[model samples]
Target: MVVLATKLYVEGDARERSLDSLRSLVDNELGELDVEFELGVRHDDFPSVTIEGEDATVARNVLREEFGEIVPDLESGETYAGTLESWDEDGIVLDAGQDKGVRISTDELGLGQGSAIQIRERYGLVQHMPLRFVYGGDGDPSRLAEEEQDRLYDWTRGDGRLNVNSATRAEVRATLNRAGHAQDYVTVERIGLLEQSVICTEDTDPPGLLASVGEYLPAELRCVVP
Candidate 1:
């Protein structure tokens, strides 16, 4: 069984829809393989997949590559994926499937900012968004992964974006289409199963787009103004 790094924190009908969507996504990823799988959510909200059959090994790897995995142990100097849990003046805490949350200090963040909250705002990082970090065990300091920093930095170099959490890609797309702003965004990039980034067109304003669709989303929305 491979536990997915992303979270399914929504409740009731939303949770069911998200699960169904995830099931379809998993099928799309592993349908070609000769494997049978079952999906379940852990107590921590991470989804797990149990696979069996001739291509189970390949399917497991495919799932791990596609949706990062939550492992049982952390080794020194190794990179791992974790969901953004909380942040403060000190740093950000990531739920890395451990008894205690992993904390990456602000200085180690290397994003060049004021406080951890300020950094999160600038990068448009939503709660529960999956982030990659390098583990520094044995009293060493952990830091955000270089590739992850690059990706967040690249967000500022673009046409601007509105990052959102607690909504699926399909739901975000539908909200934009229903709000008559379908042409405003370049695309909705999936940051995680429920976290999405709406890339604005050159002519669109990130905050304006957020204002137009915020009421319809029922989720947290933050804009990255370039």
Candidate 2:
């Protein structure tokens, strides 16, 4: 069984829809492989895939590569994926499937000035958004992965963006279209299963777009102004 790094925190009808979407997504990723699989959510909300067949090994690797895996142990200096669990003036915590959350100090964030919360806002990081980090065991300080930092930095260099949580990529796209702002956005990038980033057009205002569609999406929205 391989636990997925992404999360599924929605409840009720939305949960069912998200699960259905996940099933479809899993099929899309492993349908070609000769493996039988079952999907289940852990007590902490991370989805796990159990596969068995002649191609199970390959299937496991495919799932791990596609949706980062949550391992049982952390190796010093190794990179792993975790979901944004909380943030504070001191630092940010990532739920890395361990008894204690992984903490990355504000200074180690290396995302420029301000508090951890400020950094989160600046990067438009939504709660439960999957992030990569390099583990520094034995009293060493952990920090965000370079690739992850680069990705967030690229968001600020683009034509602005509205980052959202608790909504699927398809749901976000439909909401934008329904609100008559289809032309305002370049695309809805899927940050995680439920976290999405709406890349705006050159003239579109991220905050304005968020206000227009915020009421429609029963989700958290944050704007990244360039």
Candidate 3:
């Protein structure tokens, strides 16, 4: 398995509105390229990215162009990370790490499904240290796992009320564990005669979301009314 660092340094408002979409696209395309690209920023706020693949150099080149198009002034480089495994068209699957998987989209990439990446940069491009994430390989099994993970986290307490009718009790507990059960992630209260207390948290917004629970769990997974 190869993991490459891919960065985006653009002059647009991507850092604000398009960061998530851009990062997600990078993750997905890297998978198509048979590699793993991790998006991030350096301490100096330069846009930087890391990638891994058997055809490491080719993957780096593709991302360099892709990042450049996002931010024309992109500068790219690479430092070989050790190899892990190799697979066919689907590529190798990582255990649990930033390079585990990537996201792909035509609207996001703006080039096509699996557009050729063109930009590159190990660091010195964005405005902050690299901050990004991904979950699994490709195909049905990986997609199901990622989808379930999302559903669990979507359940939350908020809007001056708590809810969770569609969510199973087990799902609620899973989100707590995924977020580390930190105080900031969940707020609890005794309700009527229910055995379990209601849980609530504020949306941390972008960047440090992993640190904050969030303004509310996603609306679809409300705590009170279904």
Candidate 4:
């Protein structure tokens, strides 16, 4: 079965109830088409949901029925953060990275290359580095792209001499050499090396592979951005 997820934007408060009803209808109707839901949509709420199915046509019908008027069609990938190259003045043109963070800017942000844009450290794995920026809808940082939820299962660690999963530390200089990230992720190893007191999310820290991401795992197994 193919897994699918979407973050949709509804109209307004007056339509909230109607939107929810629509969500229910879509969910039920799509089920007949063999579509499974991971999350559902909401009105006045840009809710994100993931679904799985064998037929693309059925998925499209449900999408169009519920959101065709407002969003027209459900777009692919996260509308939020990650996988971006650079940003200009008005908006971001999109980077080569895998994620295209939700467009949070109001004034277009130009999507220009000349604009120096930095990744917003919004979504993080428990005590781990942020995976993406938390974007507000239409100017509000409300919903987290459904794709971010997928990354929650990711326990991959950063560069440096020590690994979080193994509970071992090595000389900072030595770790950087083996890391795929920049020197910045390397220099901070000392701090996260011993931060095992709290877990921001569930235990996804796969054993071995150096920074297995266990030390930072929160009890709930969610993302820890701060």
User: Which is the leading candidate under lDDT?
Assistant: 1
Which model scores highest in TM-score? 1
lDDT scores in order: 0.94, 0.93, 0.32, 0.33
Model 4 scores a TM of 0.21
Better lDDT candidate (2, 4): 2
Candidate 4 wrong stretches, greater than 4 Å: 1-20, 40-44, 69-226
List the candidate 2 regions with Cα displacement exceeding 4 Å.
none
lDDT string for model 3 (64-112, tens) is: 4443212312112211111111222332222112333233221221221
Q: What is the lDDT of residue 12 in candidate 3?
A: 48
Model 1 agreement with the true structure over 102-214: per-residue lDDT tens digits: 99999989899699999999999999999999998999999999999999999999999999999899999999999998889999999899999999999999988888889
Candidate 4 root-mean-square deviation in Å = 16.9
Which ten contiguous residues of candidate 2 have the minimum total lDDT? 17-26
lDDT, candidate 4, 103-214, per-residue tens: 4341333222232232221222222222233444344533334444444323223221222211212322233334432322313322222112122122222123224332
Model 4: how far is 124 from its true place, Å?
Answer: 44
Q: Supply candidate 3's per-residue lDDT for 209.
A: 35
Model 1: how far residue 21 lies from native, Å? 0.7
Candidate numbers sorted by lDDT from highest down:
1, 2, 4, 3
Q: What is the TM-score of each candidate against the true structure?
A: 0.98, 0.98, 0.24, 0.21
